[model samples]
Target: MANAFYKVPQPVNEPILNYRSGSPERKALKEALAAYKKEALDLPMYINGEWVSTDNKVAIHPPHEKKHVLAHFSKGGSDHVNAAIDAALAAQPAWERMPWQDRAAVFLKAADLISGPYRARMNAATMLGQSKNVYQAEIDCVAELADFLRFNVQYMTEIYQQQPNSSPTVWNRMEYRPLEGFVFAITPFNFTAIAGNLPAAPAMMGNVVVWKPAETQIFAAKLVMEIFHEAGLPAGVINLIYTDGPMAGDIVFSHADFAGLHFTGSTKVFQALWSMVGKNISKYRSYPRIVGETGGKDFVVAHPSADAVQVAVGLARGAFEYQGQKCSAASRAYLPESLWPAIKEKLVADLATFKMGTVEDFSNFINAVIDERSFDKISSYLAQAKKDDGVEIVAGGNCDKSEGYFVEPTVLLVKDPHYRTMEEEIFGPVLTIYVYPDAEFDTMLEQVDSTSPYALTGSIFARERSVINYVTDKLSNAAGNFYINDKPTGAVVGQQPFGGARGSGTNDKAGSVLNLYRWISPRTIKENFVTPKDYRYPFLEEA
Candidate 1:
């Protein structure tokens, strides 16, 4: 078959709408939330295009209200993993042989579905299940997920059209092939976009996937699966399973057909998985691709010339949004002594005004952490801060888990920059600040860079061009997604391709073509146009 030259539509970042008071989006989201809350959603595992059920079903509840059950998903087992792998192997040949345009159409259509009729439902599911407010839900489920779908399609076409230069008498063609085996996608609980994108990104490039989403995120993950189903994603292209991760891992990692892993989660878990893959390397047909974005102790550093109020806003949003569950959230901050007072005032005011509870209330800026474990973990941090002499609880440090796993957005002012809280990756709404002399900006930058093993996302605020340049250069390896005069969170798809180095991840830079490359293997095809009837070369004959 001859390939035709084709170009994909340029992807644009999906816009996040303000679901403000009396707005249509607010009204619709409220309606959807109410409607979804009333119903008992039985989320099933999708294997080979079939919704499969298990005897062991786990009840999933909203973190904001622990008693309120949002959905029930089957706890899959090793048998389910085996079935999924069988299905993927059965479906791989025809699916990979299918036209590239055909594969691209599925994700593009899924993006449109997310943007149109499914927008409210998707956002509502995220808010209800994940405890994200309207704005957070809109940015995650409605915008970022759609961006992943659309941008991935564009990237697929781009990957396909990259051809090698050939001699005048020869024509060289290059083809991007899917992996020889299925990819295993392990998604985190924080972002709905990540839950969908982790699996779908590889599937868009003609690979099958065995996806295990965080048990907490199955509510919205079900909706994403439905959208992909509606978009006519072929059977076994991306199978979803809700199971004990380790059980699934045991079967998948040892299998000869395990081709790759797409992961977004904790550092410990990722490291463990990597270690497992390494130990079982000799048992596999090929080395599995390990791509992960783990934990981050990201930071925000402000110079003497920086606007304290603006810096305050940046820290508040970056450190506390979604209770700072984001991998890129700013947990450590360095502030000049001159700017701390003003920034502190605004930050304290913002924290005081932040309404903490469930996401149903539109005015509530903060919500509960994921579950009791997260609640207990954060509560322990608060408890430790109260006893620690070097740190002072400046804004808020409170936890009430009677009805929900709620932890207030807490701020810590530490005398020592190397304070435990400042250097660690606490994936919660706890921001640690260290005051430095205004003239010691260079020294402070070096300290922040060396403090954390993670190099995920961070920001620097400075009005002086020279100072900005210096900070940018000095802290280049500290963060992969670096910002100027802005917060470290909220990375837009097309504009800021997100990923980080060191312990943070493989630095694949998701939301761009770079990540898509990891899923594919290239083959070069060369055809000689000149007739060669004789076996000997001209030099051989003459010599």
Candidate 2:
């Protein structure tokens, strides 16, 4: 029930050369500038109530232009992980015992901190560290972080204050208690907003947290912790350790106090974690909740009546934004045969107009992949896709990683919807297009359901009155976050909860008020205004 705030000084901006010219002088200048940038913004893991950097470090290259390397992050290990978990466990009692209003105060203060001047630095870190373009980084990392903080405060307050109608003889009250111990968040690199919400949401609901963000995105995650501290959250309320998945999983599953996991990553990784949790489910003191949003083979459907410009813009941005590294990126497109040629032509024309470069490059529309591993995986998919029968690489499949992990925005036309490229979650800037014959809508729907084991998200584009309602009804369970004329990646905090079921994940959307429900155990508290001397009420006694 105590608080303290630290005022973080704003970072001063300095001008640096751009990536347009590959001249040796410009290259040296950029490298030197990056060294200064690293010195200016080196971040560490927040463990055991302290900010500490690790001995091991990992390099980050900006995805926008690939002009220079970004800051190196602390590559924390098991020791760091255990230390953080210990801190969270120690802090859980005090945090949980605090009044809900006090807890809600921290969230409000955090929202204020995010919306203040510190937002610029958070935005910059997201842009440089993850190579997100301005709009993407600002919305996901800055604006959305604030939104999550604010929404959860209002949400948890209402939840804790819920009351039901009561007769004169009896009174009933509801209580929502945090999980027995610390909740752990294992997040991905795609959305910095998630890195903020996954842990904060649980903590705001009276649970402590241990977060293990992807190593590549540690910088952005670290900045979020600073905001938490600035908001006057007590030390040890939330813990962060930057470690790889397997090691982190070992720590999470083996710990007796581990309560739940809020995860976002590949399907394979989620499966492994799911299996690990299952192995210990019986032996644990208490059952831990499992919530995840994994890989997605999301799609975009365009009807013959769809607008050419609208379809073209949606497809291009949804396909190539963040270099298509998002789980909800539109990897597959289903076009009615009547609109196939027109859609393709418009898409090709718009793609040609896109500019590719580093985050600082104003003209660049697309950025680099997270690292070489992703670069190799995406390139390999493109290569294998080229040799496959009944598939045509349409728009862009060129890859140039001589400088950084870069792949061109690629489009493939599949002769059959069952092709591997069309079915799998490629997790890159590669998209597969399928042309369906007219009057085969039902068949196409069946094919879509069968081909995609992941139903994380999908979109439908049509103008007819019945079309919207029909598509919504048919694809009701197809996606956790569906779209009519929007991209799947920009799911807001309060409006629509994000996440999916099936192979996609357990469908616990991170930003929704519903997410807090998963981290807590609801206990009903009943008070008898007058003693119930008799055994039961008339209905129960009669039965």
Per model, how many backbone clashes are there? 0, 6
For candidate 2, the per-residue lDDT at 255 reads: 85
Which number leads on TM-score? 1
lDDT of 1 at 69: 81
Q: Model 2 over residues 135-194: C-alpha lDDT tens digits? A: 677677767877777777767766766777677878887779999988889888988988
Per-residue C-alpha lDDT of model 1 across residues 444-486, encoded as one tens digit per residue: 9889889999999999999999999988999999999999999
**In model 2, what lDDT does residue 389 have?**
86
lDDT of 2: 0.80
Query: Where is model 1 more than 4 Å wrong at Cα?
Result: 1-4, 540-543
Residue pairs with backbone overlap in model 1: none
C-alpha lDDT score of every prediction, in listed order? 0.92, 0.80
Worst 10 residues of 1 by lDDT: 1-10
